[model samples]
Target: MDSSVSSLTQYGSFRKPTFPLSNSCRHKPRRWPLALRFIKGAIHHVILVPILLHTLFTCIIVYIHINIQTLSVPANIVPSLSIVVGLMLVFRNSSSYDRYWGGRTNLQSIGTSVRNLTRSFLVCGPDRDEADRKETEKVVKVLVGMLYAVKNHLRSTWGHGYLLPEYKGLLPEGMYGFESEGVGLVLELAVVVERYIKRGVDRGAFNAPQSSMLSSQLNALVDAYGKMETIKLTPIPIAHQIHQKQVLALYCCVLPFCLVDELGWLCVPIICLICFMLYGIEGIGEEIEDPFGSDKNDIKIDAIIEDLRQEVSVLLDSWRRGGEEYTI
Candidate 1:
């Protein structure tokens, strides 16, 4: 029937292992107008508004040119003004890109954490648990659960403060977590797993070397989580952002006037196009600055979190059932 109703499902059962499902599923992106996507979201710089200003000035200049009592002004001065505006636009666009890239680099760190954690969990597990091995098997599945939790936490895709429908009921209820708190929880989970390993070693269920290696791996995962949190929360200073936006707006408004003297009536449409392009680009950069937002261009955090939840559900369920039986 419907996947969303009960909030959990396996891709299969019995003879085959199934892919887990999650309730935090996301829908496809909503399409925005081409102009709005580029101008409003891509170029938060509002670059086009300045161009509108320029267009206004150009319109004024055109009116003046057509009715001028004399063509006495030097032609070379107008060209110089055009050059200056162009240089300013170039600088503004370049700076916007720098901000966007900085955010992207931060998100990439999550991939590193995922790889390191996954390998460590798989490698450090006790292999000799065939006797009363059910508990050990369950813990192994917890690693899968942990992976999904970490992914959902980073994405901010949660329901009632839990990772999602599949994971929510399993975690401690009533506790809400932001990025910083989520990292703390992840570290705590590592500690829980470490304790289990120590217990296993003391009882001759696991080896000493494996326990130590697992500890180091978990620690590395914790470190990566911290770094990601730092990037997600920290942003460029407010004053700089404000100044950049204001300067871009003012520049666009005066662009049309500068062009009017050179292109005559043609400056109207040309200036409008220029303004739209610059503004759109700047808007895109602004949205990208915080790729975690709900904006159209923002990263699909909900979807990522949902996938994590689903994958984790598979791991946890398979573990609880005793991994030996999970043939897939």
Candidate 2:
């Protein structure tokens, strides 16, 4: 922490933070959910659900079509010959990934918001008076507090309950915590600002433009909270789910017909391999949809948020004491 005020303003540094940005913390397998076969929903699934329902549905249809049409080769091979099914599977897969990528774009917004907010703090005013110093101190504390709160909140954990020593006393006393721990801490800090502004008005420290700017910054902080929450709560629509399942199922059902002759009984393993590829893709998609989930692909909100709080606190403490002030 540096109490030795930087030549740089808070807004300047935040707008372009030297620090790394936070990202979701987990990873999930790409395979489609195994239970997808059991679950109903995808459009491809609807087509294959009937096909899968009747065990020999493909065999019976192929057997009859091949025999009736005067074909010499076995009937099982008839069902697997449609190259279009394979093509369609590829199309479904690409579409699913597009959805996943879209979500990533939204998460990036939170990072930008943090950078901007930090810059605002960096460029803002400073003072030597006890009251001004105390006001500044309160705002700085909240800045650190919000980061820690948001990180843990996104993880839906109270890791902040122990990890961040700086914000320990500032939190609510009971259960039912925030969506993001860092966000909660920031709000607490914002409350302090509002109090300070009211006090400043009485004492005549803040002028018209200064007060307006401060209020705007506070609003931006609150908006950041809403945006993160929006990302957490409103993920991709569930309809694509049913469509993806259908495509994977259809791809699997046709595999046996495609390789029955050359592989014979070995067709089972070959077919299983094919299913693995399709299922894996689907599974990974599900894991990433809600980046905040427990899946490995998730954004590690706890670690990132906690780190932010610590970093901000460290900066302020160093500036406050003009040395390595708050020792761990």
Residue range 1-328, candidate 2, lDDT tens digits: 3442452354246443444333333245636674554443333442333434433544453454456542224556544543545564555556545544543443344444444444444334345466666556666555555655655455564545556564565444442344353345446556765666566655666677776776776676667666666666665556756755665566566555655545554555555555555565555555555566544456555556555554565556555654322222
Predictions in order: lDDT: 0.54, 0.53
Query: What does the lDDT come to for candidate 1?
Result: 0.54
Model 1, range 3-49, lDDT digits (tens) per residue? 53333344253324423333333335658755455443354445545
Output the number of the TM-score-best candidate. Answer: 1
- Weakest ten-residue segment in model 2 by summed lDDT: 40-49
